[model samples]
Target: MQKFNVTPLLVMLGALGLTACGSSEQEEAPQSTKFSLGVSDAPVTEAAAVVVCFSGIQLVGNDQPPQSFTLGQDSSAADTNDLCRDAAGNVIPNTRGIDLLQLQGAASEALISNAEVAPGNYGQLRLDIAQGSYLQRLDGSRHPVQVPSNQLRLNGPTLSAGGTFSYTLEFDLRKALVDPVGIPGYFVKPTGLRLVDNSEIGHLEGLVAESFLINNQCNVNPADERAAVAAVYIYEGLDLPIAELADNGGTNTHQPYASTAVFFNNDATEYQYAIGYVDAGNYTVAISCDTTDDPENPDEVNFIVTKNITIEARQEPHQLDF
Candidate 1:
């Protein structure tokens, strides 16, 4: 059995307890709602999909001990498995996005900072996909339509201890198959119920270090840009993020050996991405040990720790044999 957990973060999550309580006083213990949904796809025509709807989302937190929620099953996994469907029956990840959710920690009622969520009545939701293509829905006239990731916003948001609500979402494969309806690649299907717990489960499982070098690559826009940038993220080998192994091979840390941002100093706005090397592994190598190289202005180069890594590929999150 391969061993993997959020070993790095365990110390940081020390003695977590419920952060806040709402004024409801429970009058009799606030009631919570559970949403379960069934999702399917249409005959593969032009590549469109539908999204489920959600409403009235509540945050369940407490005072003494911290809590966590599991998905439909007690996987105790992060966004990869803990997805939820709405009472109206739409699927969403049980997290805000790939990176926002985690293994063990306090979940407060306050809005998450830099949380990746569609604005609306959302309590940490996401979408997960296997390997095929997801289409986009275009109109409400249809069951669910396409909505840009950036356009997703909340109308009014308030979360309290032990409060609950309902929500909805739709999906469209057509729009997504076309030019515009593109949800970020990191999006995964949402599950339900954030279980409260402190015991640690595996963080991300799958091929941890998968370095692919694609040559003869096709270009999206050959005119304006010369090359393209790509990335390899860590998860349960699923879409939910575990740790980010930048193209340069950073260990979730932006040191010189690895970096999450494709461009330097742009970590704030610039997406956490990577660029595939010419040989996939070999090319102009960079490690962010110290901000030595100037992104815009060319400067001298140094090998912070350009290690040549080689490994065998098998069903990852590899098993450990005794």
Candidate 2:
């Protein structure tokens, strides 16, 4: 019965206006520049699978218009079953969603590979995660995960000619997959989405000691439930106020730059958390157990802990053990 809180939270191309130097032939058609749009995620500890049905992915450039690339129709990685429908209950192609769970622990899966487009100073990337986006439990039951507006427009990054720009769409599953009070199923708000340039951001990784995991007081767990790290909160500054650590959107001013839940590795002997595509800067990391115990009241400080560290450009995963 833990009420987890996350209070925090690419493109482009070129033209058919071909490049020709008055040559005999059209310079091999300008080679149709490619843009590789990838999909990745921060960790989500609560579910076995966070499956999102991405209908399409597009890139908008400063000079070039928005161009959409075909989704996972050819990849064996995609689930092409008719899980979606139109307003009139007609079935539509389920071409582009990725099981973000499969991309956990800073792993990335390509949504579009060498997608041919007019390359220019691309400013935005659009993702359509329409109806049929859902989650699967460890027990195998499925529940619809609501995506507000169903369209995500990520603004940042630029693509250029003959350059393969790699962009990773990160889904903060802990923050996105939220279970409201008295709500039957989890409702996913779009607030947890991030579009990061993989080449520019740093990575953060660490392990939560067994002592902290042993102290978890979350209301639900199975008999074999061993130690697990619940969530990690990363704030922009190193001097974040202690009060802000518990402030999960209760205050308009306090918010995290990025946040995600922690999960155990395949062996399950130790619990680890990882965050990818983090910008280089100083950040205050807060770790918390998924507990229903109210932090509004005193005596629950152990449920959450904070650490301050600095990350550098293109740095390998920075370690912060707790």
Candidate 3:
């Protein structure tokens, strides 16, 4: 997968300062602005749950004191319900545990809502992740999921007064969540995490016909035991050469921006996948029957079906079926 250099993007965004229009004589600008932030995720295989405990969220900018919000302290923030706990099964205090799996495909839980912050160009937004974060396997075994330095820092958004700006941090777990060999736990890197303006984001969801999966020699029976299942890989831009399309990990000409597993929806009597919080644009979506994709290395996988789709903000979820 293509590795995104977040530093350059953050630097560029930090430089785009919001300028206010007023008289030549400078007047006191509004001291604070309303900002809201949430988080969403893409799916990962073999895991029943991926939970991360967040203690606080902070915004840092030049010439201003960093603004920090403690989870569960804000009345407007979503209730965490003590989702995090100690190894002894005691609930951890002042931390919000979020299961990324529960937030897949356009669904999100607010971390900060309607919070007041100094109106300015912030350079960094940091998440104080606690150490007890973990991942539960399908067999019910759990392993600690560690974040380097117990924090994640992303490019902060430029806030302005008189308006509430909303954003969602998209966690593409396929790239960010890693299971290291010889290690007892998983790790989360910053590569697959993207912070996007809510106004410019869209959602994608669709069905995968059983015949299509069978034709591709995919495992159509959800009840069958398997190493992995079928999945849909999404790439930025349209008409991307099939040869260039690559899965997570290693150097590649083109890498999937996000991917999700196709699961049988018994209630709907169909198989489908939903990808949420995607930036509005044209994209090429590929269906791969061989879904044993590893983010630590490149794999020779087959893409049996491909199609182009467009995502428009505020519109209904873009539906693409195979």
The candidate maximizing TM-score is 3
Q: Is candidate 1 or candidate 3 better by TM-score?
A: 3
Question: Tell me, what's the RMSD of every candidate?
Answer: 21.7, 16.2, 14.0
Ranking by TM-score: 3, 2, 1
For residues 1-322, what per-residue lDDT tens digits would candidate 3 score against the true structure?
A: 8998899888776665322333322465446678899999988878888999988988998578888888778665556567788888888888889999889887998898888777888999999998679999888899999999999999889887667899999999988999899999999998889999999989999888888888778887576331245888999999988778898874668888888888776677788788998899999998888777779899877788679998899746888888
What would the TM-score be for candidate 1 when compared with the true structure?
0.20
Candidate 1 lDDT tens digits, 1-322? 9986776566445423122233334454544433322122111121123232222122222222212233332332223232223345455544322111111111122112122222223333333222222224323122222233423322223233343322222121111222223534323222111221112111111111112211212112212121122222111121222223232223333322222212111223221222111011211223322222222233332222222232122212222110
Give candidate 2 misplaced runs (Cα > 4 Å): 1-33, 61-64, 72-94, 179-187, 215-229, 264-268, 291-303
lDDT of 2 by residue, 1-322 (tens): 8974544211111222233343436545564466666777865544677767777776777675677654545342234556555456565675555678777556788776666667666687777777766777767787777666777776746666677666777876655567666766666655677777777778888877666666665322333242234767788988777565543343324466776656555466566778887877899987766522221232242326688989876746788887
lDDT of 3 at 106: 78
Tell me the TM-score of model 2: 0.72
Rank by lDDT (best first): 3, 2, 1
Task: List the candidate 1 regions with Cα displacement exceeding 4 Å.
Answer: 1-28, 37-72, 75-124, 130-167, 179-322
Q: For candidate 1, what is the lDDT?
A: 0.24
Best model number under lDDT: 3
